[model samples]
Target: MALKILSGCINCDMCEPECPNQAISMGEKIYEINPDLCTECVGFYDKPTCISVCPIDVIITDPAHIESKESLLEKFKHLVNTDRI
Candidate 1:
């Protein structure tokens, strides 16, 4: 599944760069995560970096965009030229 930035976001700009897929961006008043680009760092890292650095724990899973692990791994490979999954 993809991720979403909840209302609790502090806009501290900590989670932006941590996202390998470049899914997070500044919105009108807060940061937003692009579900199309978010792969939960499945292929890039062991865990989601945005969630790791978010001080307010604003990053949360998008239950609506439920995707299987295989799909996420494929999406990650399409984003970055990585051989591992």
Candidate 2:
């Protein structure tokens, strides 16, 4: 599943650069994760790097964008093939 930043995010800027897919970016108030680009690091790492580096546990799976590991891997492959990574 894709990840989303919760309301309590500190905007620490720790996640944006850590995302291998460049799925994270600064939003109007805090950082936001692009669901279309987020794969929870399935193809890049065992765990999401954003979550790993987050000082606060504000990042969580997006229930609205639920997906399985296979789907995430497919998305990762698509991103790579399209040069969107």
Model 1 CA lDDT for position 70:
98
Best by TM-score: 2
lDDT of each: 0.88, 0.96
- The residue ranges of model 1 lying beyond 4 angstroms of the native Cα positions read 81-85
Summing lDDT over every window of 10 consecutive residues in candidate 2, give the lowest-scoring window.
76-85
Cα displacement (angstroms), candidate 2, residue 77, comes to 0.5
Compare the candidates by lDDT and give the number of the best one: 2
- How well does model 2 score by local distance difference test? 0.96
lDDT of 1 by residue, 10-67 (tens): 8999999898888999999899999989999998789899989988887899988899
- Per-residue alpha-carbon lDDT of candidate 2 for residues 9-85, written as tens digits (9 for 90 to 100): 99998999999999999999999999999999998899999999999999999999999999999999999999954
Q: Give TM per candidate.
A: 0.89, 0.96
